[model samples]
Every structure is written in C-alpha cells, then in structure tokens.
Target: MAKALIKYALTALLLCTGLAGAQAQESGSSAARKAVPKIQDGWLDVRAGEGQGRLPIHVSRDWSQAQPAVRRALIVVHGITRDDLLAGERAAAKVPSAADDAIIITPQFLIAEDVAAHQLPELTLRWGVDDWKAGFKAQAPAPLSAYAVMDAIFARLLDRQLFPNLQSIVLAGHSAGGQYLQRYALFGQGSALVDQAGVRLRYVVANPSSYAYANDLRPLAAGGFAAADASQCERVDRWPYSLSANLPAYARKPLDPAALMRRYLAHDVIYLLGEEDKDPHHPQLDKSCAGEAQGDSRLQRGRYYFAYAAQFPRDAAFKQRLFIVPGVAHNSTRMFGSSCGLAALFDEGRCTTEVAAP
Candidate 1:
C-alpha cells in the first residue's frame, strides 16, 4: 500500500510541473514578439559636422533590420539635381537578391535650402556643369572632395561594430552619377582602406556623358584618334580628358599618367550604357566644346571610350567590361530593371550588350 501511494503522488507532481513550464514558455514568446521596435522607412539624420551640419541620407527600412544571411550592400547615387529616389533602388536591389539581405543606401549630395533654413554648416560639395565629377576639393570652408564623401560613407559601413558581417559593397551610378563612379573607381583613395578591411567592392558606371581619357587626344568621327589641337579645344587636354593642366588643390599629389592609367585598368568595373540614350539634343547633354570632343551623344561616347581602352598599351588584359540595356533610354528605372542592370546590381543573372535597341 505504501509503495502504490508513493508512485501515484510522484506522477501527479510531474504533470503539474510540466503544465506550469508550458505556460511560462508561451508567455516568453509573447514578450519576445512585442520587443521588436516598430519601424517606418524614411531618411536618416546622419550625425556629422562634415556637410550641412547633419547629412540627411535616404535609407531603406530593411537597412534598419539586420543584414540577411547573404550579407551584401548596394549604394545607388542620384543624378545631379534629382529628387530623392533611394526608395526605388532599394526595391530594385531586392528584386534580384531575393534570398539575400542587401542594404541599399542613397546619399544626398546637394542639400541647399535645408541647410540654410536650419543654419547648418556648409559641407555639401557642388560644382559647375560637371566639375564635381572630376573629384576636386571644395573651394572654401572645408577642403573635402566629393570622393572624400564616399570615403566617409565607407568608413561608417566598415565599422565592424555596426555591420559586423558585411561581405561586399557595390557602388553604382547613372548619368552624372556614372561619371563619378568611373573616375572614383580609377583614382579614388578611399578604396584601399576598404580592401585592407577585407571587404569587396565593385563599380558600376551607367550611361555617363563621357569617360576619362588617359591621353590628351580625342576620337575622330572617321574611325581614328588624335590629339586635341590647342588651336581647337584648348581645355580638352586637361583634367577630365587627361591628367594635365592644373588640377584643384585636392590633387596635391601629382599622379603619373602611365601609372594612373595602369591602376585604373586593373579594378573591377562595369560600363553600363543605355542604347536609346542617343539623343544628341537632350536638354541635359554635356554640349561644351570639351564634351563635343569625345562624341556627339551618350551612346557614341561610351562606345568610343570602350574601344579606346581596349586598344590601349598594346591591348593590355582589361578587367573593365561594357554592357548595354536594350530599348532603355536615359531612364533610371528601366536601366536598373533590365537583365544587364540586374546583373550589375546583384551577382545573379547573365548580362549582355548584344540586345537590339527597342
């Protein structure tokens, strides 16, 4: 009788204890679900005194969340005087890397009134026509260059405390933005820092008005190239065309032409051009005497640049490749959404320039 009573009491005690533990587990899950902060997608108040007191960078909501297991980043820059369009890029990057968590960033460069109204410090970089694209130092107050802004951006990302598991970053631009990418890829000083930290970076230049030529000569209409005669376009052989003439104070270190060209050719870069951006009379086209020296339209300029690079230094093994988005004009949406664009933005899908223009 004593043994039977002891066995029955032990069985009842175990059942009650298990029931209480189950209730506690359910309560813990409920508390965990409530702990996640409610997030709304918008801009970030970049706490820095560099530009405009505090830079207002448009960021994707996903960036607020943890980087998905894939660990990738895509930074999309807007064209000159364009409204905030980072939300678009965020969606585009997401489309291709559905399985991967990619954080998309679009840093605003020219915030004029916002800074003025707020009485914030003047730190944003600006230039005439396309001078900023060449990466010159700001004239007054702060001596930072547009390329310096890119450096600061990477510094924030490379902070292991912030993005501990980041693997790769893609820097891309369209139109004037593309112009920035091409030059920065070749000569930007900040890239070495990221490389040292063991993070990979790729440049995607899309539909820019021109390319930085290694020499003073420009391509002719009848299938050949020649030097820019002083009597013709005097400034053609300077800065953007060739590393000649007096550059801004920012380029304190004189770069050897031969060494610079070789270094540029070695980086991983993609030249993405749109087939339908062939209008010679586009309102925003670079029609200065120097721009005309390159080619008549965006398409012509890109083709000539690629051809020039390919035949340089006795046909050096080039790492740069040119891609064209079919039937796409000077439109950002179509360019990034195309198969070629998707391939550049994300490491998935095949890209080609053989498609016919629609």
Candidate 2:
C-alpha cells in the first residue's frame, strides 16, 4: 500500500508540472501577442474614388521638400509581423553605396486587434490577420484594397517636385511580403504609374511561400510541369494561386492570360531563394494544396517558378533573374543582407546568378 501510494503521488506531481508548464507557455504567448505595436510612425493618405483612408508607414526622409540628391527609392515591405520600420531600415543599411541617394518607405498593414488595442480612429484602415497579404479589402472605414495603399504611395513618388532626381525604384519584399509583391506585380496599377513617370522599376521577391501561376499547370515531383488534379483540390486555380475570375476588387476585370504573362515576363524581377530554406514541414510555410502544388519547400517553389517562367515567350524587354543565396534560411535580415540582396538593390555586389547542378 505504501509503494502504491508513492507511485500514485509521483505520477500526480508529474501531471501537475506538465499542466503548469503548458499554462505558463500559453500565458507567455498571449503576452507577446499583446506586445505588438498598434501603429507605425507616419500616415499615408490614400483616397480612391469616394473611399479615403490613412495607412501607417515609415519614411526614411521628409518627402515634403524636394530631395534632389535622392536618385533611387527603396520601398520595402515587411512579412507577417507588420514590422515595417525595422524592415525598411535594415534593407537600406544593406546598400553599400551612397546612403542619401535612396529614400526608403515601409508601410504597415494593421489588424482589428491593433486598432482596438490602441483605440485608433475609425478612418484608420485595418484588415483580417493575414488577408492584407493577398490584397483583400479593408474591414473598417471604407472597403479599400491594401494594394491601393501602395498605389497612393507610388503616385506620390511620381511627383517630380518631391523627388526630381529619382531615377529608379526598387520594390522589394521577403516571405509574406514577397508573396504580396509577386501578386501585386501582376495586378496592381502602381507599375503603370512608374512607367508613366519614366522611372525604372524593379521588383525583388525573396523567399515567398508560393508563386502565382498563370495556368493550371503545376510542378511535378520528378522534374516537369503537369496540370493539377482538380479532384484532389477544387480551389487549386483560385485567385492568389492562379489567375482566375474570383479576384479582389483591386484587380477589377479578369485579365487576359497571354497578355498578363507577357507583361510579367517583360518586367524586371529578381528572385532570391535561400539555399537552406528547404524544410518541407516549416511551421510558417504554406501547406495548403495550392502551395504544395507549386513545390514541397520555398526553395523548390522558387526554382520551379523560375523554370516555369522561362517556358513562356518574353518580349524584347524581358529581364528576370534568379539567385540562390547560400547558407541562409527563411530569415529576412540575412537574406536581404547577403551579396545577392545588395546587388539586386544597389547593382554593386557580385551575386551568383545561376543555380548549381543537382
């Protein structure tokens, strides 16, 4: 009876310890979630038709006056954390050239909890936790697409009075931000604004979870492309995955596939893939059927997408380059701070342009 009692008491103590540890972990996570900032440093006025809203952004310099020395602009987008300030600053610091030659702007997309936590004004735009990453319409104030915020910023940048010497614009993002830019590059009207202003535009997509396919074709495990089995996942060809009719209001009408493909190919896009980011079961990696249809890992998805784009007939202006960053994972700072990242931004460093043989 004494031995039985001792065993039972020891088991009870172990269970109690486990339960306490779980509760402590849960409490710590809740505290960390609550610690995220409610807003950014500056406000960007975005007005589309009758819908007017304010976006929180971090501008490296005061745009009110003319920045004649500014020859390049770097618009860096943050990942899921919405920490734009740190992202923008870190990217700018990676450039080894003249510091004042470029202006950096980073925009933050807030959520309902953020507005509620800080009691922000109603006109301050907000979206669902991860919806903004896909150009979803904002929840409060006016129904505005998050891409429209980028449009407004682009329009402001086109002003010669503010940035008279601005020659090129490097729109870059990492992870979720890369996903946003990859989709926005196809549908967003901001690129047209840059073209009209006669400013060179470049997009640097780094380590996104997935890519937007122009067709039903997906990468095969062995080596080639094949149409996805719709019987397995019905929504394989949906928006944000492939070009479909079910697009956000920002995209407006359904685009012609051929034209869209041609336009995207003609645009200069630099893809950066991390060599060490090959974990198939990464917690933050997109595990949906659509994502898996692309590849098993971020690195594979990037390689597959680059090869897929090569199959298309690009115009004379085609300028797409892909670089594999050695010894890096799904880290924003390390990926963007590498030689390839600096070359993609400042056109100075020597980045490896070709992938190694398997």
Residue 152, candidate 1: alpha-carbon lDDT:
65
**Candidate 1 C-alpha error for residue 252, in Å:** 4.7
Best by lDDT: 2
Cα RMSD, model 1: 26.0
What stretches of model 1 exceed 4 Å from their correct place? Answer: 1-54, 61-70, 87-100, 111-129, 139-141, 314-316, 354-358
Candidate 2 lDDT score relative to the true structure: 0.77
TM-scores across all candidates? 0.77, 0.87
Best-fitting candidate, measured by TM-score?
Answer: 2
lDDT of 1 by residue, 70-147 (tens): 367778766654343553464465474644566777765543333444454554333332445667654433545666
Off by over 4 Å in 2: 1-35, 356-358
lDDT of 2 by residue, 275-297 (tens): 99999777667666666667778
